[model samples]
Structures are given as C-alpha cells and as structure tokens.
Target: MAQEMTPTQLQAWRALYRADTLLFTHIENTLRARLKMSYFEHEVLRILDAAGGRLRMAPLAEQLMISRSGATRLVGKLEEKDGYVARRNTPEDRRATWAELTDDGRKALKEAQPVVEAVVATFFADHVSNEDLRAASRILDVLADANPNDDGFDCGL
Candidate 1:
C-alpha cells in the first residue's frame, strides 16, 4: 500500500482544494445571479482581454482546462448574446480558429471586473496576508511543477 500524506502535505492540499472550491462556487453564483454570466465565462473574457482581446480556441481550452468542443460550445452560447464574441479562421492555419472579443464582450467584461474583484477580495484575499500569498504562490508553483500533466496552474488565471 502507498504511504499516507504527511500533516503538512494534507494541510496544504486541503487548504488549496477547499479554497478553490468555495471560491469558484461563490464567484460563479454571484456572476450568475447578478450578471447572468458564469464564472467560467468571466474567466474566458479575462483571459481573452489580457491577450489583447483575442486567443485561439485550442489555447483557450487548454488554459481553461476544458475540451476543444466544450470551448466551442461555450463560445457559441456567448456569441448569440449581442455579438459578445466573434469566431474567425486563422488564415495561416485553417484548422486553428480564433475567438475575438467584440465590443460588447469588452463592455460586459469591464462591468464584471469590479464585481469579480470585490468578491475575490472579500472571500479570498482579505483573509490572507501579502507574505502568505507570496509563499502560497511559490508552494503552488512547486506543486504544479510536480504534476506537469495536470495543466492547471494558479499563475495561469
């Protein structure tokens, strides 16, 4: 049988897992009830926004830890809502498609930014000190490096 985790390991794992779960639920619910956007949606917008308002479908999927088809489906839904997004073929690579954030999408993202910031500050950041955040980030990086195949990094979002 495999050995059990040490107390330090367990604490770190539980703290990160619990915090992520609770934060995701709280942020997603707040967006859904107040802004009619899912937390995933906000994340996509933020990513695209950070990437100069455009990112290819595959990279976006990889960043979000979802499948290609799932990304397409989610983008399709958002596309219908007043042209929030536009999909285009990458001329150099027909197989690669791009999702460009439209003006409406940017507007929506701008509006949602404060809501997200506030919720995050209230639920996550407020409880942690600056030094702890730095240490947590480093610990997470170490953890992520140990599990490279997982492709989920705290630094990504």
Candidate 2:
C-alpha cells in the first residue's frame, strides 16, 4: 500500500499548486494584453532569441521540452501571425529544417520585454527573498534532473 500524505503535507502541496497556477495565469494575462502573445509563444521567441537568433528544429524542440511536431505547429502559428520566424532546409541535412527568428521577431521580443520584466518582478521577485529564490531554483533544478524526461510531463498527444 502506498503511504498517505499528512494533512500538513497535503495543504503544502495544494498551496504550491495554487501559487504556480496563479503565477502563470498572471503572466499569461499580462502577456496577452500587452504583447498579444501566449506564454508558450513568448517562450518560443525567447528561446530563439537566446540561441543566437536561430536553431535547428530538433534542437529547438529539445530545448523547449516539446516534441518536434509540437514545435512545428507552434512555429507555424507564429509564422502565420507575425511572420517573425521562418523554416529553412538545413544545408548539412536536407531532411532537417531550421527555425530562424526574423528581424520582426526580435523587434516583437524587444517590445514585450518591458511588460514581461515588470510582471516578473512584481509577481515573483517582490514576493520572494533572494535566498528563497535561490533555494527554489535549486530544488526545481534537482527535480528536473531526477525526471526521465527533462520536461516534467509526458508529451502525450
């Protein structure tokens, strides 16, 4: 038989879940209103921006903890809406394509930065001490490392 959590443990789990949900909700709303971008969309752009402004589809999918198809779909949506990303066949591997962030994508990211930064600071930083933040980061990093997939959830579709 599996051991049951105590009431305190259950409460702690619930609190953490609620906190995470609220944090994401807050960020999502802010991003949608200010930048017309979903959280996932923002994340995609941010990752591309950080990766010297381009990345192969497979590597980008891995880095984003998403499947290739999922990344392709997301990239397609971004391409349709903003024309900020393009897919090109890799010269080294004709079978593979690269997702490159366009100049417009860089500009969109730059425009969104201020709003995202303020939201992050207000919702996360203002509430947590530096030590608490560092400890939380360490804990999450450990949890991620222990998981079979670097992503916490199975990308079942």
For residues 1-157, could you state the per-residue lDDT of candidate 2 as single tens digits?
A: 9899999989977987888888889889999998789877887889999999888887887777878888899898888888888888866789988888999999988888788788888888899999999998998788668875654342541
Clashes of each: 0, 0
Instruction: Please give, for residues 1-157, the per-residue lDDT of candidate 1 as tens digits.
Output: 9899999989978988999999988899999988899987887888899999999998888777777788888788878774778998967999888999999999989989999998999999999999999998998899767876454443322
Model 2 C-alpha RMSD to native:
2.2
What TM-score does model 1 achieve against the real structure?
Answer: 0.87
Candidates in order, TM-scores: namely 0.87, 0.88
Clashing residue pairs for model 1: none
Candidate with the greatest lDDT versus the true structure: 1
What does candidate 1 score in Cα RMSD to the true structure?
Answer: 3.3
